[model samples]
Target chain A: MNPAARSADGSRRVLLMLLLPGLVALGVTFVLPLLWLFRASFASSAIGAFSGGDWTLSSYETVLTDPFYWLVAWNTLVLGFNVAVFTVILSYPIALFLARTESRWRGVLTALAVAPLLTSSVVRTYGWMVILGDQGVINSTLQALSLTDGVVRLTNNSFGATVALIEIFMPYAILAMLSGFGRLNTQLEEAAAMLGANRLKVFTRIILPLSLPGVLTAALLVFVLAISAFVTPRLMGGGRVFVLGTEVYNEATVTLNWPLAAALSVLLLVLFSSVIVIYQRALRALEA
Target chain B: MTIRTSISRRAAVASALAIGLSLLSPAAMAQDTSVTGTVNVIGFSGVFAENYEKFIIEPFEAKYPGIDVTYRPSKNSAETLALLTLQRGNPEIDVALIDVSVAIKANQEGLFAQLDPAKVPNIADAPDWARLDGDRAVAFSQDNLAILYNTDNVKEPPTSWNDLTDPKYKGKIAAKLGDTRGVILLPILTKLKGGDYKESIDPGMEMLKEIAPNVSTWEPAPDCYAVVQSGEVDLSICWNGRAQYLHDTQGGKIAVALPKEGSIGQTNTIGLVEGSKNKEAAELFVNYALSAEAQATFAEKSFYGPVNTKVELPDEVASRIYGSKEAQAAQMSLDWNFVADQYSPWIQRINREVIARY
Candidate 1:
C-alpha cells in the first residue's frame, strides 16, 4: 500500500476504536431490544402463547385496522402538537428574559425556571391533581367567591393532562431556547430602532428570525417528550384518555398481550422516525 | 382482649410443636448448613410488598437461616405474568404471588408447578374455594369489591349497586376501570340488569354507558381511595379491604359498603414455578406462608381476609373483612378462570364503546 493509504487506514482504525464503546453500548441497549420487540410484534397472541409461539402479522393487522388504535394514535399526535406549540409560546418569554436580563435576580429566576425539572414528573403530576381535582383548591375557591354555581370539571380529562404536560415540558423548551439565544446581539435591536423600525417590527424581523431555530428545536424536544410521556397522561387522564403510550402500557401490562404492545411500540417508533424526517426537512428549508 | 390472648397462646403452642416436629421427615421442614441455595420469588409491590416482606418473608428467612429467600416485587400481576412467560422453562423465579385471574393465565402457560399436598399440608385447612388452577396454585388472600363513599360529602352512604346511577351522584362517582376492578364491574352490572357477562358483555356495556355520565372520572388519579379521601368525588367502586383499612387510617372520612346486591371477592394466589431448581426450599416457603400463624399475622396487619379458615381474627378485625358467614354470603360468585379469558376483550369493549363514547 502507498504511504497515504497506510495513514488513512491507521486513522480509520483509530476512529473505529474511539467509536467502538458507544457503538457496542447502543447495540446492546437499543438495537437488541428493538430486534426483540420486532420479533415479539410478530409472535402469536393466541391463548397461552409465550413470545416464541409463532410468527404472524395479526398484531400489526389489529393495530393498523382498529379504529380504537387510530384514536389512541390521534390522541398522542394531538397532545404532542399542542404541547409543542404551548411550550414554545409559554417558554419564549422566559428564555428571552434569561438571555437579556442584567438584574441580580436573573440567576435565581433562571434557577427557579429550571427547578421543576429536578423533581420527578410523577410528583409534579400529582401536584397538578391536587390543584385540578374536583374538590381541589380551584373549585373550592371558585365556589367560595360565588363565581360559579357548580364546580367545573377541570381534571381527569384531556384538558388537565394537556395543561400538566405543557408545564412539565416548559423547562426543557426554556433551556433549549436560552442556548439558542447565545449569539443574539442587543445592538441589532438598537440598530433596527435607529433605522425607524417599531419595537414589534424589530422583534418580528430580527429577533424572531434569529431565534426561529431555537423555537423549532424547543418545539421538537417538547413534542417528542409529550408524545412518549407515560405517567402524566395515565394519572391525569384518569384512564379516560388513551394515547399511544398509555395504550402500549395497557396492552403489555394490563392485558398481558405482548404482541399487540410490541406492534403499538413499533408504530410509535415509526411516528418518531416521521418526526425526525419532518424536522430535518424543516431545518433544511429554513437554511435554504 | 381475651380472644387476642387465647389466639396468641394457641399460636405459641403450635409453633413450639411445629419446631419440635420439623427436623424428622418430609412432612415438616427445617434447615441446616447443607441447604444454602437462594429461592428467588416475585410478588406484589408498594406498601403491601413491604409489609409482606417484613411479616412473612423475614420470618421465613429467620426460621431457615441457612437458605436465602430473595423477594423481587413487580408493579402488578400482569407484569409478573409477562416476566414468567418470557422466562418460561429456564425459570428464574422459584415462586410467584399474583391475582387469581393472572395466576390462571400463567398456569395456562405452564408457568407454575402442581402443588403436592403432602409437601404443603396447610392447603387442607383452606376452603375449597381457595384451591385453584387444578392445585397448581392456591389463594392466600382476598379483598372483596364494594362501594366506597366519602363520609363528609355523602350524607347517606350508598346501599345498593344501582345507587351508582342515581341522579344525585351525577358527575360524582370515581370509577376505576380496567384490570380486576373493571373485569369485576362488567359481570356484576351484567348480572344486575338480567344478563350474563360471559355470554355477552353488551348488557354490562350498556349498563356502564348509562352510568358513564354520572362517572366523575372513569379513571381516578393516584387511585379511587385517594380521590375519595380528598373529597374529589363522593363515591368510588373499589376493593373493600383497602377502603375499610383507610376508614380507620384516615379517621373515618370514608366508609366501605358491600351494597344490597352484594359484591365480588378478588383473591390473590401464590404458586411454585414449574421449572424452579430450588423446589424443596420453595415448597417450604409456600408451606410456611400458608400456615395459620403466617395468615393470621398478615390478616391482622393488612385488613385482607386470610384464605386459611383456621386463622381466627378478633371481632374488630373480622368485622371489617369478609371473615364472617354473613359477609361471605354477600360475596357474589365469580369464576376468575373464566374472567382470565374475558378480561382483555371486556376492557377493549368498555374503553371504546363506554369510556370513549361517553
Candidate 2:
C-alpha cells in the first residue's frame, strides 16, 4: 500500500482503539442494565430471583388495564406538556433579553436566570413549599391586605407542582433558546422593520421561523426533565398529585414490585420515544 | 541498612503497644483475634441511625476491637430489601436492620442467612413472635403508630383515631402515603368502624374518602413531623418514636396520642446477609444488638420498644414504650405477611380513589 493510504488506515485503527473503552463502558453500564430491566418486566412477582420465576405478561397487563395507572400516565403526559409550554413561554423573553442586551447587567441577569440550577431541585422545591404554603408569605400578604377572609390552598395540588416544576426547568429552556438566538442574524429583522413591518410581524414571520429548532429543542429538554422529575412533584404536590415518576418510585421501593415498576418505566420510555420521533419528523417537514 | 533498622524498631514498638492493650483487656484481645474484619451493616438512616450508632454500634465496636463496624444507612425497609435483592449474588452488606414485615419478605426471597442460635445466644432473649423463619430474622425494636398533634395549634388533644375526621380539623390533617404508618391507618380505621381486614376495607376507604378534604397533604415526602412542627397542619398520623423525639427535641411543640382504639405495632428486625464475607463478625454484631443492655439503651434513648423480654427499662422510659403488660395488650397485632401482599393494591386504591377524589 502507498504510505498515505497506509497512514489513513492506521489513523482509523487508532480511532477505533480510542473509542473501544467508552463503547464497552456504555454497553456494560447502560445497555446491560436496560436489557436486565426489560427482562425483569416480564417476570412474575417473585422477589430476589430476577430469572427462573414464572414468566408472564401480568405486569404489563396490570399497567395497561388499570385505570389508576392510566390516570397517572395521563397526569405525567399533561404535566410534561404543560411544564414544557409554560417554560418556553416564560423563558423566551429572558432568552431574548440575554441575546439582545449589551449592558453590563446582562451577565447579572443571565446568572440570576441560571442561579436556581446551581442549587438542588429538592432545596428549591422546599423553598417553593415555604413560599406557597397555607400560611406562607403569599397567604400572609393576602391576609394583611385583607384580600380574602380565609387562607387559600396554594400548595399540595397540581398548581403548586406545576409552578415548582416550571421554576426548576425554566433555566434549561432559556439556555436552549439563548443558544438558538445567538445563531440568529439581526440583519433580517432590522431589514424587515425598515420595510415598515411591525415588531409583531417581524417576530412572527422571520425570528420565530428561524428559531423553530431552538424552540423545539427547549420544549423537548424541559418536557423530558419535568415528566421524569420525582423530587419536585413529590414534595410540591404533597402526594395529592399522582404521576408516573412517583408511581414508579412507590412500586419499586415502597411496594417492592420491581416487575410492575419496570413495566411502567418501559411504557414511559415508549411514550416519550414516540413523541420524540413524531416531533423530529415534524421538524424535518418544517425545515423541508 | 539504616531503613531496615528503623522499620524493625517501629515494628518492635507496635508489638509492645499491642502487648500493653492485650494486658489491659484480655477479653477484647481474645475477641480481636477471632473476629478481625469489617462488618458492613445496612440499616435505617436519619435519627434512628444516629441513635443506633450511639447506643448499639459504638458499644459493639468498643467491646470488639478486632471487628470494625461499617454502617450503610437506607431510607426505608423497602429500599433496604431492594438493595439486598440487587446484591444477592455478590452481597456487599454483612448485616441488615430492616422492618420485620420487609425482613419476612426478604427471607422468602432467600436474601438472609439462617441465623445460628449457637453463634448468637441472645436470640433466646427475644420473644417467640420476634423470631421469624427459624431465626433468619430477629425483631430487635418496635415502634407504634400514633396520632401527632401540634401542641400550640391543638388545645384539646385527640383521644380517638376518628378525631382526624372531625369537621374542626378540616384542611389541617397531614398524612404520609406509601409508608407503614399510612398503610396501618386502614386497619386502625377498619377496627374503629367495626370492620375486619379479612372481609372488606370498604368502610375504611369510605371513611378515608370522607376525611379526604381534611387531609392537607396525603404525601408528606420527607416526613409528617416537619409539616406538623411548622404548624402548617394541626394534626398528623406518624410513628410514636419520631413524634416523641420531635416533641422532646423541638421545644415540646408536638405530642403523641395512642388513641383509645389502640395503635399498630411496627417491628424492626436485624439479620445476617446471606453470602456475607464476614459472617462471624456479623453474627457477633447481631447477638450484641439483641442483648438486654443494648435493647434497654436503645429503647431508652430512641423511645423504640424493646423486643428482648429480659430488658429492664427505667420506669419513665417504660411509660413511654409499649412494654407494660397492659400497653402490650393495647398494641394491635397485624398479619404482616397479609399486609405485605395487600399493600400494593391498597396503596393504589388510596392514590386513585381517596387522594384523587380530594
Candidate 3:
C-alpha cells in the first residue's frame, strides 16, 4: 500500500477508537433504558412489589380506547404546535437582531434574550403564576386602572400555561434561529436590494427562504420540549389542563401504574418521531 | 526486585489497616448502637419534612448521640412505595413515612416489617384504628378535610358542604382535583345525600356536577391555600392542618371550618421498611416518633392532630385541630383498602365526566 493511504488508514482507526467510548455510553444510558421501557410497556399488572409480570397488550388497549386519554393527547398536540409556531414567529426578529447587529450592546442583549434558560423552569413557571394569578400583578393593575370590573382568571387555564411554555422555550428557538441566520449570505440580500427589491420583498423572498432550515429546526425543538413539558402545565394550568406529560406523571406517581406510564411514553415518542419525519420530508421537498 | 518489595510492603500495611478498622468497628458499635451507624429515613418533602426534621429527627438525634440520621424526602406516598418496590430485597431506606392508605397498600405488598411490640412499645399508645395490618404500620398524625374560606371575602363562614353548591358561591370557589381532598369530597357528598361508600356514589356525582360550575379553578392545596389567602377565591376545600398552619403563619387570612355535616379524616403512617440493614436504629426512631412527647411536639409545631391517645393537646391547638372530642368522633372514617381499590376509577370518572364537563 502507498504510504499516504496507510497514513489515512491509521487516522481512520484512531477516529474509530475515539468514537467507541461515546457509542458505548449512549448504548448503556439511552438505548438500554429505552429497551427496558419498551419491555415494561407490555407488562400485565401495574401493581404490587414487582413492576413486571406477563407480557400483554392491555396497557396499549386501555390507552388507545379511552376517550379521556385521546382528549389529553389532542390537547398535548395542540399545545405543542401552538407553542412551536408562536416561539418561531416571536423569535425571528430577535434572532435576526442578534445575528446581523455589530452594536456595542449586542452581547448584553443576547445574554438578556437567553437569561430565562439559566433559571429553573419551575421557578420561572412560579414567577408567571405570581404575575398572572387572579389577584396578581396583571389583574390588580387592570382593576386599579378600572380596565376591568372583576378579577380575570389567567393562571389556572390553557392560556396561562401556553404563555408560560412559550416564555420558557423561546430561548431555544431564538438560539436555533440565530445559528441559521448566521449561516446566511448577507450579500445575497444586498444584491436583491440593489436590484430594486423592496425591504418587504427582500425579507419575504430572500431572508425567509434562506432561513427555512433554522425556522424548522427551532419549531421542532420547541414543539418537542413543549409537548413533553410537565412543570409548566401542572403548575400554571393548575390541574385544569390535562396533557400527555401530566398523565404520564399521574400514572407513574399517583396511580403507580408503571405499565400505563411506559405505554403513554411510547405513544409520545412515536408522535414526536412522526412529526420529525414529516418535517424532514417537507424540508427536503422545499430544497428540491 | 526493589519495586516488588515495595508493593509487598504496601499490601501488608493495607491489610493491617483493614484489620485494625474491623477490630475498632465492633468496639465502636458496642459503645453506642444509636450513634455508630446511619438510619436512612424516607418521608414527605417540603414543609412537612422540614417540620419532621425540626420536631422529631433532630430531637431524636440529639438524644441518641453518635447515630447519624439521614432524611431522604419523597414527593408522595405512591412515589415512596414505588421506590421501596424498586429497592425490594435490598432496601435502601430504613424507615418510611407515608399516607395511611398507601401504607395499607404497601403492607399488603409486604414492603414493611412487622413491628415487634417489645421493640416499638409506644405503638400501644396509638389508637386501635391507627394500628394497621397487625402492627406492620401505625398512624402518627392526622388531618381533616375542611371548608376553607378567605376572611376578607367570606362574610359568613360555611357551615355545611352544601354551601359550596349555593348560588352565592358561583364563580368564587376553587375546586381541587386529583388529590385526597377531592377524593374525600365525594364520600362527604354521598353521606350528605343519604348514601355511603359501600352503596352508591351517584348522588355525590350529581352534586359534584352541580357544584362544578361554581368552581373557578381546580388548583390543589398549597396552591389552593394561596388562592384563598390572596382573596382570589371566596372559598376552597382543603386540609385543616395546612389551612390552620398557613392561617397562623400568614397572619390569619385563611380560616378552616369543619362542616356541620362531617369532615373526612386523613391519617399519615410510619413503618419500618422490609430488609432494612439498620432495623434496630429504625425501630428506635419509630418508637420515639409514636411516643406522646414526639406526637405532641409535631402536633404543636405543624398543627397536625396526633394519633397517640396519650397526647394531651392545649386548648388553642385542640380547637384549631379536629375540634372537640365529640366533633372528632363525628369525623368520617374511611375504609382505605376499599378506597385504594376504587381510587383510579373514581379519579377517571371525575376527570372525564365532571372536570371535563365543567
Candidate 4:
C-alpha cells in the first residue's frame, strides 16, 4: 500500500480504538439491561414476588387492554404537552435575552439560569410541597387579601404537577432553544423595523421564524423530560394525579410486578423513540 | 402438611432451648465465639436506619465481637425486597429488616430462610401475633396508625376517627390515599363498622369517601410529619412512632392521638436471608436484636413499638407503641398475609373510587 493510504488506515484504526470503550460501555450498561428488561416484560410474574414464570405476552396485553392504564397514559401525555408548552414559553424571552445580550455579566446570568439543575430534584420537589401546601405561602397570601373564603387547593393535582414541572424543565428548554438562536441577527430585525414593521411584525417576520427551530427542539426536549418525570409529579401530585410514571413506580416497587413495570417502561421507550424520529424528520424538512 | 410438621418441630426445638437458656446467666446467652464472620444487614433509611445502627446494631456487635456486621440502608421495604430478590442467586445480605407485608411476600417466595429457632432462641420472646410465617420471620417493632394533629391548628384534638369527617376539619386534613397506611386503614375502619375485611371493605371505602372533603392533600411530601408540624394541614393519618418522634423533636408542634375506635399495627420484621454465606453469624445478630435489652433500648430511643412483650417502656412511650398490653388489646389484628394479596387491588380501588370522587 502507498504511504498515505497506510497512514490513513492507521488513523482509522486509532479512531476505532478510541471509540471501542464507549461502544463496550453502552453495550454492557444500556443494551444488555434493555434486553434483560424486554425478556422480563415477557415473563409471567407472580402477584407479589420476583417476576419469573413461563414467557408470555400477558404483561403487554394487560398494559394495552387496561382502561385504567390508558387513562394514566392519556394524563401523562397531557401533562407532558402542558409542561413542554409552558417551559418553552417561559424560557423563550430569557433565552433570547441571553443570546442577544452583550453585557459582561452574561456568564453569571447564564449560570443562574442553569443553577436549579444543580440542586437535587428531591430537594426541589420538597420545596414545592412546602410552598404549595394548603396553608402555604400562596394560600395564606390569598386568604389575607380576602380573595376567597378559604385556602385554594394548589398542590396534589395536575395543576400543581404542571407548575412544578415547567420550573424544573425551564433550564433544559433554554439550552435547547439556544441551539437554534445561532443564526439570529439583529440586522434582520433592524431592516424589518426600518421597512415600517412594528415590533410585533418584526418579531413575527424575522426573529420568530429565524428562531422557530430552537422553539420546536426546546418543546420536544421538555415534553420528553416531562413525560418521564417521576419525582416532581409524584410529590406534587400528592396521590391524586396518577400518571404513567407514578403508575409504573407503583407497579414495580409497591405491587412487586416487575414484568408489568418493564412492559410500561417499554411503552415509554417507544414513545420517546417516536418523538426523536419526529424531531429528526421535522428538522430535516425545515432544513430542506 | 409437611410444612406444618417442620415448623412445629422447629418451634419445639426453639422452646426446648429457651427453657435451658433461662437457667443460664444472661451473659451466657450471648453466642459462642466460634461463629465468626460478617453479617450483612439491610433496613430502612432516615432516622430508622440511624437508630437501628446505634441501638440494636452497635450492641449486637459489642455482645458478639466475633461476628462483624455491615450495615446497608435502603429507601423502604419494597426496595429491600427488590435487592434481596436480585441477590437471591448470590445473596449479599444475610439478614434484612422489612415491613411485615413485604416479609410475608418474601417468605412466600422463599427469599427468607425458615429461621432456625435453635440458632435464634429469643424467638420465644416474640408474642403470638408478632411471630409470623410460622417462625420463619418475627416482628421486631410495631408502628400503629394514629391521628396526627397540629397542636396550633387543632384546638380540639381528634379523639375518634369519626371526628375527621366533621365539618370543622373540612379542607384541613392530609391523608395517604393509596399507600400502605391507606390499605391498612381499610381493615381498621371495617372492624370499627362491624364488617369483616375479608368479606368486604365497603364500610371502610364509604367512610374514606365521607372523610374525602377534609383531605387537603392526598400525598404529604417529605412525609406526613413535616406537613403537620408546619401546620400546613390541621391533621393527618400517619404512623404513631414517627409522629411521636416528631412531636418531641419539633417541641410539641405535632400530637398523636390513638382514636377510641382503635387502630392497626404495621409490623417490621427481620429474618435470615435464604442463601446467606454466614448463617450462624446472621442468626446470632437476629437473636441479639430480638432480646429484651435491644428491644427496650430501640423502642425508648426510636419510639418504635417493641414487639418483645418482655420489654418495659415508660407510660408515655408505652402509649406510643402498640407493644404495650393496653395498646395491644386496643389494636385490631390484621392478617397481613391476606392483606398482602389484596394490597394492589385495594390501592386501585382507593384511586379509582374513593380518591377519584373527592
Pairs of residues at least 3 apart in sequence or in different chains that clash in candidate 2? none
Clashing pairs in 1: A238-B219
Give a tens-digit lDDT track for model 1, residues B223-256: 8898888887889999877787688777998888
What are the lDDT scores of the predictions, listed in order? 0.85, 0.85, 0.84, 0.85
Ranking of candidates on TM-score, top first: 4, 2, 1, 3
Q: Which stretches of candidate 4 lie over 4 Å from their true place?
A: A46-53, A102-108, B1-34, B125-129, B292-297, B308-317, B322-328
Candidate 2 residue-wise lDDT, A1-288, digit = tens: 999999999999999999999999999999998888888888886472264467789999999998878989899999999999999998887888788788889989898989878999899898998899888899999999999888799989999999999999999999988887655678999999999999999989988888778888899999989888888888888887788888888888877788998998899888889888998899889879
Docking verdict class for candidate 1: medium
Number of colliding residue pairs in model 4: 0
The candidate that wins on DockQ is 1
For candidate 2 chain A, which ten residues in a row score worst on lDDT? A45-54
Give me the runs in candidate 2 sitting further than 4 Å from their true place.
Answer: A46-55, A104-108, B1-38, B60-68, B89-92, B117-121, B276-281, B312-315, B322-329
Off by over 4 Å in 1: A1-8, A46-53, A102-109, B1-39, B50-70, B121-131, B288-301, B306-318, B323-327
Q: Single out the weakest 10-residue window by summed lDDT for candidate 3 chain B.
A: B26-35
DockQ of 3: 0.31
- Tens-place lDDT digits, model 2, residues B304-328: 9888999877877866665344555
- Over the true interface, candidate 3 deviates by an RMSD, in Å, of 2.3
Clash pairs, model 3 backbone = B35-B66, B35-B67
DockQ-based class of model 2 = medium
Write model 4 residue lDDT over B202-253, tens digit each, in one string.
9998888889988877878768888889877889999987888778787999
What local lDDT does model 4 show for residue A67?
92
